[model samples]
Target: MSHRPRTAEAIWQAADLPARRLAGVALNPTAGTDVLLGLLACDSAAVRMTLCRDRDLPEEVVNAVLTHPDHRTRSFFAANPHIDPAQRARLVDDAHWLVRARLAQGPGFSHGRSELPEHTVVRILTTYDREHLDTLYRQVPRSARWTFPSHPEPKVRAFACDWWSELTPRERSALLADPDEEVREHALRNGRDLDPEYVERVLPDRACHARTHLLMHGALSRRVVEQVLAAPVGREDLAMIAGNPSLPLDVLALLARDPDPQVRETVAGRPELTAEQRRALATDTDSAVRTRISVHPALTEEERAAIDYRVSSDETFGRFDIPARMYDPARSRHYALSGHPLLRRRAAHDPGLPPDLVARLSCDADPGVRVLLAQNHPQAPAELLLDSFLAYTGRERWSLTTRPNFPTEDLAGYAGAADPMVRRLALLSPQTPPGTVAQLSADPDPDVRADAARHPRLSPRRLVELLDDEELAHEAAANPALPPPVLDRLVAALDG
Candidate 1:
């Protein structure tokens, strides 16, 4: 046999190794980009890790490989810190899990649950490992120690707040270093809101932190956030501070060019944002910036149309987080008409359904669309909600039963209805009352009995009086809230 190597197999094999391992040991500095790119282009996902490791690669070449149609190519870019915000934003909604997983690491990404993909969140919180969290936030000091008091998500900042007090000054500066106004505000808030000395701890350029803390606690002059915004020295830092509801218009303009779409979003999200701000963000080159404008309920159709213009390309849509817009009744209808399935899915999630649209969509061909409307309390018609419950039966018992908002009383009545799932939801409805739980205790389905048996609000004494059944007795005892006196009665019943 000839000694010539199989290039394709070699490329594919190279892609199977861990990205860090591939990036480590420098696979021979003398090797050509062709070998590197060939492995990057391989069928294996492992290539992404290696491509991210190459710091010496040219920017255009890196961008080209990043922008490659394959998701793995983009994954490499997300892992590469050198990729800028605009380019990094390109991977925000990449089709492959690994690509988005990689993107989650970049410094500016994943600020809120609103932007987080569901699977990624599941992976981050439930994966039983901090690898993904660490991968995305390796550069961020104590990624779990997110500080910066003004952050819109209170819990994350609070956790960070507790962590911040424990850190050195360099760590404190990282908390305020981001261009976010909330980050500044949080740092200003440092141990105490009223103390000026606490405010002195923030980095000088992002003095909006200290200023915002003072103004928030009513310790400083009016328009302190605005004053910071107008300062030429920290205009970028101040616009974020000015993002506070209390900041004036001129101050917000100073933050207008902030590289972060989220800052722009914060400005757009404010119902009171001015016409000039709307125009600027609506025309922003980034679709996310434009999506922020598009999702706003206050925008005129003409203004929204301008945003629609920027959204023509699929690339632009990836940068958009349309679900935020879908909650708006007016914009949701617009999204429902969009060509994208995901946007339509979001629109379908809106609680408000016009009577005619509601009627038409009750039989929507898409199961997810039908299911979403069933879940929406505001727009979903009562009849549709009921129909949706009845329509779901043996399909998946847990899905219908788990919804916290299903109409319990009405569902209880529907126990006599066709669908077992409907009957189950009806029985479990919070409003099912003691009367309904009693009735369903002896129902034919074990699952239904189990649900009632386990309900914390239901009295185990009621369970004994009602169930007169064996398995139900064990479940009723499990509830710690069940009065101990009830256990005595349960034991008496067993004795009988």
Candidate 2:
């Protein structure tokens, strides 16, 4: 057989190597517009995702993804967190509903970035059906919600009415009398939660989620409570009634003594619990009920300490750390000073804690409290960030390094640390020596090696050597330290 040199195009067109080649090229920050455009021609979905979804693309590549024949590729681009929201919003009117829905959901993991443009938000609200609207509603930025009630689009106005409880009296009145029937109806339905008669009429006879909502959140008349009690309610219904703020003292006392421990647990959470009720539930047979009472705001720290309450490590952190616009600093301060560690964990989620509270919680015995503080507070101590990063390996572990106060001054000292994650931190330090970068490039841990390969401190000669390295090629190409001439030549070969 005659031997011929393989062309770059042939290598990229090959079945087995294309995915690797495409990934390496896609990750190359120095890859020019032409090279990126060339990679888009590759039919591999993984390549497309790596190209369009993983990193911010050049304008030409973004345009190509916008018009790509594959809707799935377009969908991936739609949810990409790296791109501008306006760029993602371009897909709002996509021919495919799935693509539009993805656009409506905004970026998959926004780290407090800007929201979609107001006009784009209105366009999605007007076009999306109920199912897509529900998804879009959750992702809508809190800043946008305040303005939605005044939006010119009726659909947007109506969408705002869904949060009627949050609206000011004036905004509610305007929506109720708005010309648009749909907007008016949404306001009426949500506002009716305050109407004792309406709640009584709509309260379902059976135990359903809607009934639970009414029993727990709706304004309950004495008659409504009596009617609910008259029915043979389930454990859930009793629990919901126990939690209702409007529950009469007699009913509250009745539920406190209910046979189901869950009902007593809910009663323990009621803000209206009498001194006697509190004393009684603090020693309830159920540990969960006692635990619930242990953190009651009404109790003194000394009183809370006296209760034999147990805090589960599992309940310490998870969704509690997610940023919420409505998070109250006062409430967080209350929790931060509470005797219970679980409440302290919740308090640590507040980003605006006073310097005193921050200092106090940074030394909290609970690891979750410290980690939550590190994850949320902008001014979280550098030591706390490093400590949390080393200790916690749960969701958003990488987020700890992104904190504003995350220490980078002496991270190179961790290069020889036993933990691979600690070893990876060495690459983040500006003071890391080139020799350490080169040494870590051959680390046994794939993640540490990949991160080291992408460090700008890696020697030019070694960076070029890694271009042929299958495992490290993509990460090496992403390194900004690659020489211009070497990068141009690589792009030229890939462009072919």
Candidate 3:
């Protein structure tokens, strides 16, 4: 028999209903002030949290909820605009740091009308949530932006660096010279018209990442570059300069043969290389350098084919579809045996790789090549599959478990694995023992239990047991194993 739909009054009168259900009822326009006032006394934090943010909450109700012991409840209440200015001011000194921080960052605190004492300003600036600082920026005064760059807190100074437009040239220069690296980096990056003399001063002392940003931002000077190169810096320092696209062709040539293969490789890919320079690099001993030179636009078709024996560059990789097929048999065989794991890893997925070579990759020391072999090779060994599953716990395990006709021998082991997702896939597998499904139905994680609830082999009795679980009830009720009468009861319970 069909029961009548619950009316608002009936829902309110049903005091035993879950607090979350009552919270939803409180949102309805028909819930009278008496019903709302009664809900304010609810023991559920979730219900009180919802009511705390309600704009239409009566002053008396707001006052009552304000005294709620839960910090989260009071935090949401403090966020409500209806709180009087006097009360809002008092809330800044609330026992909870977050509650006070929220009020300090609120509009009234930053709008010049509510002046936070210097100590309170320092406290909020140091401890307030970083996520809310972007919103706080707009509410803060123009004059106050100057104080933060020099603030004792690094985070406060770093954040204040963003408001560069508000700072005078002297303040900007001071931040540029800030003793803290992050503060100086932020100032240099965001501050405009950075003095060339200042840029030169920081070049040698600045970190590599800072130098990269400086180059990218067009802040580097020719004099600074010459000074750094003239001094005995490491190859890494030179390599960084070589990578900059703005470097002159003469400097690129000088660095091209700079002893370090890495430095030469960085120079080889420079778009400014002349045809002669490209031809010179084609014969360089470093395969990495030759690989980059092979794709240079200046190289003739013949030059590209001569060095085409190896696949080492992104352009070379891009030329082929999956199961790469461009290399010669000897080259493919060479890569399969190459000591370098990078080549062996690439060859694992090469369709042209000889069957013997492909099989050899199964024992590759690098797990990545084995992972590729497992996913692409039809006859991949069981050890390779299992090893990849346990070693690389990324999404590949899920893919391996769900692949059609995956070996039944592996299913049992995975069915008992500690990872919930691995067990979840096992529960969905046809080969998973019925006993395992029954055990997983009671797994602590709701999602794992939900997966078990949807299994086709689940017993009707087990499905019935899950009908009252708030998280899994819907999935359990829909289980094909559920008996018709039990399903009807579940649907009715869920409806109410």
Candidate 4:
């Protein structure tokens, strides 16, 4: 006979998440407080919100509901005017949450009055959460706008940046100069384009600002970028200028002499440069600069070989994750191979490729490339991965193997593979049979043996019997789901 669930209100009542979700579609406002309390106090959120709507709930019940840790219940009690204003203000700091808020303000608004008549504005300003940005779109100056730019939270300062149109230009300038970098960056990244005068003033004067840093480093606007290039001040300042995509042919020639290969490489990649500029970069003292010319989309394959390749640049930080916003084909091109192996390692996992490109990368002799490939290629073929696993496991080693999904048939053969990394991986797979897991537990590799000992199919008695195997028992104990008494007995067995 099929088993029936007991305790209709217990955990078993809902067989799955969907059933749990459907259990409280509607709430009874007039329901007795007993049922209301049971639902509101439950771990099940559906039951809590449903019970919070009881209109006839006793004032004490409503008041107690406000103290609940759940945001929705506190929000409900906040809307219920029955809660006293003084009590609501106190709730703002309520270890739970402040339930009382402004209801008298026009449609779609809620403001909590401060204790002091005049200081309410300050209180409202202090309470704002900038991430919930839409909430501030319509509130009045006294209610939602914070006049200060130095708020402790940059997100709140970011919110203040949106109110630029309403503030005086001086106030806007003050925000641009705000000490918080994210506040300045967010303002420029999203707000209306800054006037050229403001842009110039901000870039040089606000040199410490992160947006200015990005602007000097990778600015897109032509006129603004040219100005930074003309004012070559320092290596860092020069790096910022050359990094801009708007560099001209004449400017690229000047920058190609930069002591930093990183700076010269940026100039070499610009399409705006003439053929002479490209040809000049081909022989530029820095190997990285020449590499840029060879790999540039505009270069012909014939040009790549004709230009003598020299290795000059030793860039350590050239590799980075593929930018999510890299729509330009040039942004994704990889021409300069870095000497630093770590840089090449990160580049291997970047999801920047079509499947074919990743497959081509698999042939890369760098073991780190192989490892990164196994770790990150979202579309990595199972066949290629199985072969790699078989090859590595046959060596019987433990190491920095990137997690790769292997085929089922290959997993059985891998149990005997010499590499513990490969053997441990096989034991870890969900598809491995209980018998296979048990068999692998007795393998020579301590790691593979440990995983087998901790396998869910292993009985507590069996686990207790294996207490003499220190590493296996220790690994099994790390599984918190294992019974405390069983674990305690096993640990005690160490000495016994």
Q: What is the C-alpha lDDT of each candidate?
A: 0.51, 0.81, 0.62, 0.51
Provide the TM-score for each candidate, comma-separated: 0.32, 0.80, 0.40, 0.45
Q: Model 1 off-target regions past 4 Å?
A: 1-223, 226-240, 271-274, 308-383, 386-449, 452-496
lDDT, candidate 1, 1-496, per-residue tens: 4243234245445542223223321232433465455545544444444455334455555666766887545665665544444455455556666666565665344222223333333334333233545543332333244333334453344325444546677756655564656555666556454343443333244445544444434322333443454563543444345345545556567556677666676666566767777788788877666776676657655656556433331111111212333467776677666444335556666555466655655566655555565654345555555555555433432443334444445455765655455556765566667767766666788877766765655655675443334445434544443565554443333224
Q: Write the per-residue lDDT of candidate 4 for residues 266-354, one digit (tens) a residue.
A: 77777676787788788888776776676555766677767656432222211233333443333323521433333345456565556
Off by over 4 Å in 2: 1-16, 37-45, 58-74, 93-98, 129-131, 188-208, 219-233, 314-340, 412-473, 481-490
RMSD in angstroms between candidate 3 and the native structure over all alpha carbons: 16.4
Off by over 4 Å in 4: 1-128, 131-195, 204-233, 246-249, 305-379, 386-405, 408-423, 429-450, 453-496
Give the TM-score ranking, best first. 2, 4, 3, 1
TM-score of 2: 0.80
Which parts of model 3 have CA positions greater than 4 angstroms off? 1-198, 204-209, 215-218, 294-305, 308-436, 439-496
Candidate 2 lDDT over residue span 158-238, tens digit each: 999888878899999999999999999998988998888999888888878898899889999989888767775675777
- 2 against 4, candidate with superior lDDT: 2
lDDT of 3 by residue, 132-229 (tens): 45555533444566578778887678778887867887888888898899889888778643555666666546556666555444345678668657
